[model samples]
Target: MPHNSIPVIETKRLVLRGPEAGDYPDFRATFSSYRSRFMGGPLTPYETWMLYAAEIGHWQIRGYGMWMIHDRTTDKPLGMAGGWKPAQWPEAEIAWIIWPETAGHGYALEATHAARGYLYGRLGWEGAVSYLDPKNLDSIRLAERLGAKKDTGAQTVDGNDICYRHPSPAQLKNTQISDGIELEIAHYADPKFRPEGYALD
Candidate 1:
């Protein structure tokens, strides 16, 4: 494969890399369905494009954004996982989405572990949180699976968006990624793939 400007992160069975046009169709389908209710979605086509473009644009503006999660065996895009920080947010957030077909396969849980590790290891972030709608039980459970705790003191958008703070840098000082996870984050990552001026290793 050719070199990617964005760093490619590998886990046990998936590849996390930059988003592209091929990922849009699946994304649109989710955002158009009830599955997206917690994400302020069920958006119109115009709104979907805007949200999709913003996700891609976030990488340009912030140097770190969501990665398209692809199955290593099939190389087919399954979902997305990574970080996002808009201007209004108090801190960056770890985010993920597993397509309907991949639901219950533990893909989001696995992909998120890699993404969170990347944020702390390569991105040089001191902390991060995952914001979810109060009713987004799936996301809340995922956050809990990642060892995140509900941060009631954190600020939210529109007095909503329950915040789940991930394991802090100090908390994950050791045992960051799971034992079964094989990360290509450091040794195989691009030397130039620094996020916001932070080195990969």
Candidate 2:
């Protein structure tokens, strides 16, 4: 069996860490907003708890999960980005979401690029996928921005939503991928891999 080699991911304005038990309130608040309902339901408190629990489980079971996004300056929680592999997906999925306040600021792209770098270059994951709703123009644009192509033949995870497949060699130019993190690739490829709290420990 392989060891868990996943490292915590960070961005210029955010920290992507594994979800903890205390994230329910923020998760509930974020997920319940109108901004979030377009992609998925605005979950109830219990539902938010369950979701975070599953996210943590993803890290434990699959070695990666939806990361808890925190503000780099104030350390306030913001949103999430990382890899997900539900029982039904064909490949590991790259997922991201930002609070409404954090929207339009490029947080999603930033966190996502970093997460992809870790998953592919460090963890040796070659195939990463993303599921998007056709109606969510913002997400589609982000997918294209990240070089993900629309998968016309891809099946939806739920009864709704279309799937988008990211090109293996795709790289977003404007998004920042930090150097000082403690991951294998960060230590080797990035000069700043362990920047501040960005360390894996």
For all predicted structures, in order, the TM-scores are 0.84, 0.77
Off by over 4 Å in 1: 1-4, 175-201
Q: Tens digits of per-residue lDDT for model 1 on 124-187? A: 8887898989887888877876778999998875577888988777776656434323233232
lDDT by residue (1-201, candidate 2, tens digit) is: 112344666665667777766766777777776767765667776776777778777777777777777777887777788888879786678988877776655567667777887787878776677988778788777777667888878767885777888766434323331221223333323455423432121
**Ten residues in a row with the worst lDDT in model 2?**
173-182
**Full-model lDDT, candidate 1:** 0.78
**Best lDDT among the predictions, by candidate number:** 1
What lDDT is reached at residue 44 by model 2? 70
lDDT of each: 0.78, 0.69
- Candidate 2, residue 110: the lDDT equals 69
